[model samples]
Target: MTTITAGRLREAAELLGIRNQATLNEIRARYSERVKEWHPDVSQNDPAESHEMTIRLKEAYDLLTDYCMNRPVSFRLEDLEKDLEQSPADYWMERFGDDPIWG
Candidate 1:
């Protein structure tokens, strides 16, 4: 039940050089490229800097993946308010459909 703000999502997207609309595949590809570029053993830069960059890239990738997986289809204020009015089960059912195992 952690709340994810739009600002956080935008920051993660920017760090990974991706648009807000990027798909999971796009995120994974970009993350792979960045990891290769910043991997301490591969980059031949100051190991500390390379390690830091790789850590940052992994963090951004995790954040974006979590956001994308849990995000609602849209974020209109009115829609959120309406969703809040529903019971948790109803809200999840509406958002994710009737996947029995997940719901």
Candidate 2:
């Protein structure tokens, strides 16, 4: 229902130093670190920058948290089983090496 753009999402991710595919906990931890690093009460020497950064960081945190909270998730048994059961070679072989010529 939100009207967020891809650019805005990318900005939020970059602001919080989040890499691709972060879980909610990772996003929260990164936001906490960034806030602590820039909060005006803690970084008194640069209160102006700290204040500005704190505001930006909070917005980024809210955007990221909102996006994550609304994302759809799957919990099918086969999906979980696939994650736990795959080995590197088996994965490659099943997908690529199964071809008679390639194998």
Candidate 3:
């Protein structure tokens, strides 16, 4: 798997309407709220933002998943797969079982 750059992750957050670094719970809560608000069904009045929000949501999720999986020092390979299955976009199994130090 490729290394995840902080710049790319930050960019994803910005696209997802996230203005600051956040915990996993914070990311999930905020992402859900934004998705609900911008869902095409909910935001019929603004199709443009809705479409953009969809793409942004995916990016944000991927970045958050990658970041999270790459953190824990004792991360496990099976856990990575579980994470991916539970939240594929944010799972990032590849990064977890790689080098001892991602840096």
Best by TM-score: 2
Best by lDDT: 2
TM agreement with the true structure for every prediction = 0.63, 0.71, 0.56
Off by over 4 Å in 2: 78-103
Stretches of model 1 off by over 4 angstroms after superposition: 1-3, 73-103
Better of 1 and 3 by lDDT: 1
Of the two candidates 1 and 3, the one with more favorable TM-score, higher being better, is 1
Clashing pairs in 2: none
Cα lDDT of model 2 by residue, 1-103, tens digit: 5577888999999999986668899999999998888889988657888899999999999998998898877789988887879897887787779688888
The Cα local distance difference test for each model comes to 0.84, 0.87, 0.73
Instruction: Give residue 13's error in model 3 in angstroms.
Output: 1.8
Residues 6-90 of candidate 3: C-alpha lDDT, one tens digit per residue: 8888877876667865777878887888788778887865788788777778767877877887686645998866655756433
Model 3 stretches with alpha carbons more than 4 Å out? 1-3, 74-103
| Error in Å for residue 24 of model 2 | 0.6
Ranking by TM-score: 2, 1, 3
| Reference-based lDDT, residue 91, model 1 | 62
